[model samples]
Target: MARPRTQLLSRDIILDAALELINTQHDFTILGIGRHLGVNPSSLYHHLSGGRDEIINALRERFYKNIDLASLQPGHSPWQSRIESWVRSYREAVAQYPAAIPILIGRIVDDVPTLAIYETLAAILVEAGVPGSQHVGIIAMLDALVFGSAIDAGSPEPLWNTTEDRQPHLHQAVASSSTPDRVASGLAMGIEASVAYIERLAVGPSDGAN
Candidate 1:
């Protein structure tokens, strides 16, 4: 009889291990991931042929997979509403793994699901009368807002320590802010500003205005 096989190690397991490393350590190597999983680094290659880069792409997919894309479907809803929904969902998904932000940003996005989300956004931008030339720039700006907000979401509460004596204006602003959820409030404001900017682009510059 053949010897019994060892415990199974699969792609999900490897990816989870890698994500754990990224979350705690802010980065991971193939060796580190394998060590976490109590397996040899070479064994990860069996599941991920492309190695570290592949793992990074996989993690990107994992992060974006949580976004609910149904509201984003082209429909009767105004483009602004769709964009807001997407931003909220994207932030919610990413904020859960804020530590992964640095690692994810370091890699160019090549994940298919993630790209599909961008493609959807691009289509919406096209429908909104945004010029094709500006699509990438708008998307980049939105990414900055969303990712920055996500990172901020993970920051310690009372993000700034201000005192009336040292910084009266800042302390007053922080204390007087009406919104309980600063991150959400700020993200909503940013989204509205971005949408307004996009609308202006759609309308195009006036003849007399400089």
Candidate 2:
């Protein structure tokens, strides 16, 4: 008799494959996930004990683990550049895995692993001379730019839709178009300006007496 197949696929392995399937196919429906994984749909219950929620949790953790903050290079790169790079990294991640956005947004607050990343970001901002007063706003801006970029990339329909009569302002805004890269750069510049403004508040003239 042939030896028994002994490879054990854990939850992480299952989720990793699932995410890749979603990336390649953008299919979130139950049947799609089952077909993509090449396993009986019911078998997913073995790994994802709680169903979709379990899968989402696993994916979120995997995303946090894959983050390449090594590029931040704390001592070498200015905080502003690091912040921009961080935001860019997030945008790139979400663009590649659009299906994760909704899960990310919904689960962010409760997910300890995801919240730790934000905590690291906040600590960096504080160390970079950002006043405590502005921490909340800075975090909000970062979140908005990241999730907004993901939304834009994943669904461009909002940019193209017209409602000139009902939503005149949105129509006019859409008329003035820019490349996604330009938009991300503009957001980064805005973040830099906010940081600079805070730094200026701490600035003082040199003392010639010393």
Candidate 3:
């Protein structure tokens, strides 16, 4: 008697499928995933733990999997360049999955690569003479800039439409700066401004005791 072949499933399959769901459905349930993969929802539990939160962590890991810290390390580039490069890389990764940005932000980052990013950024900041006392606030500001920029990258073209009759100055400004990728330009400016602020902070004192 010939035996029936069983289906094989892996973490990669779940991750890919989940990402697809996030891209399309934007609201997928466990049963939905099971239907999509033709597997029992319980089977998914065998590989993924913590339910939706775990999936979110996996998604973030996939997004940030390729973040290289070498270029952003202290010796490789100036501190300002490092910050700008890191922000650029983060925005690039985050821009891919706009729908799940909230999930990523809501979950605590426990992924190894993500942790390494924080570690490297801290080390670089320390090298730049940023004291430990200010690290949290500065990092928060940087994160806001990066994540906000990521979200802004997907903004609709000509995002604002102000009528000249209603608001002439606003309309004129919008027209003067109108372009296909103004969001991208804004992101660049935000990163540069954050870096400039860091430079100013580096001037005052060596609180890092370096």
Candidate 4:
């Protein structure tokens, strides 16, 4: 249950409403969120100067709040497991609103939570013997894979179907697979392989962007 809209509104109220809209629905606009909150669209402008971007950033902040950085500490878990945990937490958050994955990816990540995760990741990569020069490429690769996996998780079952007379081999491959999507397994192994690669390289991290 929720309280009915009132004349009094605050920035926190508006952002909570915005994230609620995003979670349950596909896309949301300023006016749409205003309507959800039973307020005039223009009223939102009094709170958010950058409008939609700010809302999305707030949504990211909300999502990251669930992630416990303390659990990802070096000694608490193996460096590889820490990486997987971060990816798992990230994917779980994004899975709540699969459509917003692209929105998050397209935006610049300057939020404190996101930056902290990146910094932790940077430090972990360094500990794993990765050169700092490759950190950008590694993060980019992980983001692409992890985010793509999240999108795939939300995809409809039977990602592909076939006609009896066409694409026999393709259909066979799909049929032989145990699940409709291999996102979970694929992502798990992908993370492991990434960790293995770093371990194999055995190169120390150099000067890097924090």
lDDT of each: 0.84, 0.66, 0.78, 0.77
Q: Give the per-residue lDDT digits (tens) of candidate 1, residues 1-210.
A: 976586568989998888788778988999898788887899899989999989888877877887777767766477877888878888887888899888888988788978888888897887787898899999999999989999999888889999899999999999999998998889989999998888888754322121
Q: Which should have the higher TM-score, number 1 or number 2?
A: 1
Model 4 residue pairs with clashes: none
Candidate 3 or 1, higher TM-score: 1
- Model 4: lDDT of residue 179: 60
Question: What are the per-residue Cα lDDT tens digits for candidate 3 across 53-136?
Answer: 677778778898878877786457567677778888887888888877876787788877778878887877778876678888
lDDT of candidate 2 over 125-185, digit per residue (tens): 7656666777788788778877777666655444467788987997887777665564565
Write one digit per residue (lDDT tens) for candidate 4, span 13-131: 88778767766786678989888988899989888877988877877887778888888776776777787887888778777778778778778988787899889888788777787
Candidate 2 Cα outliers beyond 4 Å, as residue runs: 1-13, 16-51, 71-73, 108-113, 157-210
Worst 10 residues of 2 by lDDT: 201-210
Q: Give me the runs in candidate 4 sitting further than 4 Å from their true place.
A: 1-13, 16-26, 46-50, 179-181, 204-210
If both were scored by lDDT, which would come out higher, candidate 3 or candidate 4? 3
lDDT of 3 at 50: 71
Candidate 2 residue pairs in backbone clash: none
Off by over 4 Å in 3: 1-8, 178-180, 203-210
> What is the clash count of model 1?
0
